[model samples]
Target: GVGAGGDMPNWMTFLISDVPLYLIAMPVAVVLMGKSTVIETRKFNMKPGMFFKLLLMCLPMMWVGSMVGSMLSLALSDGEATNRVADLAMQTNIWNVVFLVILGPIFEEWMFRKQLIDHTRKYGEKTAILLSGLAFGLFHMNLFQFFYAFLLGVMFGYIYMRTSKLRYSTAMHMIINFNGGVLAPWILTRVDLDQLDKVSQAAENGNVAAMEQWASQNATGLAIMLVYFLLYGAVILAGFVLLIRNFRKAEFYIAPEELPRGVRAKTVYGNVGMVTFIVLTVLLTAISLFL
Candidate 1:
């Protein structure tokens, strides 16, 4: 049976509720994209240092995009969409882990980064990257993640264009997801939220001594929690600094024949397929933010 009362398993539930579009749309994307398209975008090899350089460059942009999304979530909504991740975390199982950290990245990279790039790269690389980013961001179906996903979509598309390999993008995606899903959750378990609540209560009651006592007792846990956040912040800061310092030095390849900006935009995204996807995602995002 799928569940105690014959309900679907958590993984199935997640797949159905979260990503049914990917399941349905990918086949249509495939039929729409014939075999020759895949061949033209075949993955290529790159030097080891190049991969790290790209990672360092792109990771900071992703962080900035996420921060922007967070601000937008705070301003435009009650963060209900972003907060849903906590609810999802409660239902964690092997399948969720597999899908989140492994299968999900692979499949998404293939569809959004790989297929989209292949489908549009012939027209213009920059246009392809922009379109891929838009699709990827909108695919998240919420304002809380749209900015970051879109930025990452562009970065992933660029990486694919540079290396021509799905593995590079997939590995980067897995690394980010693992840190967010696995490492972050593990760190949370090490922190004592109940104790913090108690401390808050004591302070509210004007019990400074009790608050101090609780803090002293839980000093080690507090230190660990503080250090964990500090470490993450430091890494993001360093990555941002490095990315900015190297921005102009980063490589850009020339397209075969550059289209006018308007023509390029239309060539990549002004079609039934692109418009339908954009409208669907925009509607869903609006619902998530407003409803």
Candidate 2:
């Protein structure tokens, strides 16, 4: 049932594809890497205020990355870019919500933040964060998602590095996915785009009657959309301010078995697998923009 046409339900598709990758492939890979890669479990505890501040501080990066990605996609596709991920996100349902808002964060954090970081932290904390973030972004294999995913990945990676707790990063990831994959889509669905387009045309042609008719008919939807955008804009602005205030306070520590500064790049990228992954993902991302 899982085909190119996306005939299968979202949960079923996730089970077939994502479940296997998380449960089987990643575990197998970790086991092959040996006992040294095991992540030490730690209690998850972050002050509510700290969590809120961290979230706000990272929002600007998310906003900027999203803008860049969207602009690049538009340019590459000559303004005809189609985001299949956004299309899927718009198909709001309980199953989709559960997967996107809950299960996704659990599995993804365990894989990318917990597993990948555990194995790579020996190189250096910064290196581990960057590696996990870059890999996470590239793994999406979509031009529209790469930038923001990478930015958020780094934020989550830092949280996990500092706390050594999956729960912290997992919770943050959940909130983000909930916003993008659930709440935003729901808000968008409340508005009728076709009618909005008609209303816009009417306004452009100075058709007062038609424009007023739309305003009256879709008052509730308009209000909902207006509130959503206003709140979103506020969050972005707060995040930008927080980022500027906290930029100097950010910290990184020397990692165990840290690589030398001069050879860190070589140690990380001069590998057969990493090179192959970067090249292939870049190609796929580029191809996705065209598609």
Error of model 2, residue 119, in angstroms: 0.9
**lDDT to native, each model:** 0.72, 0.80
* Candidate 1 overall lDDT versus native: 0.72
* Top of the candidates by lDDT: 2
Tens-place lDDT digits, model 2, residues 1-291? 011125666667656656766678678756854665553545567898999989887778888988888888888889998776777777788866677778778878887898888888887999989999998888777778789989999999999988888887888788888888888988887877778898798889998888788778878888998999999899989999988888788788876688998998888877776788789878978777776
Angstrom error of the Cα, residue 250, model 1: value is 3.4
RMSD of each: 4.0, 2.7
User: What TM-score number comes out for model 2?
Assistant: 0.90
The ten-residue window of minimal lDDT in model 1 covers 1-10
Q: Candidate 2, after superposition: displacement of residue 15 in Å?
A: 4.9
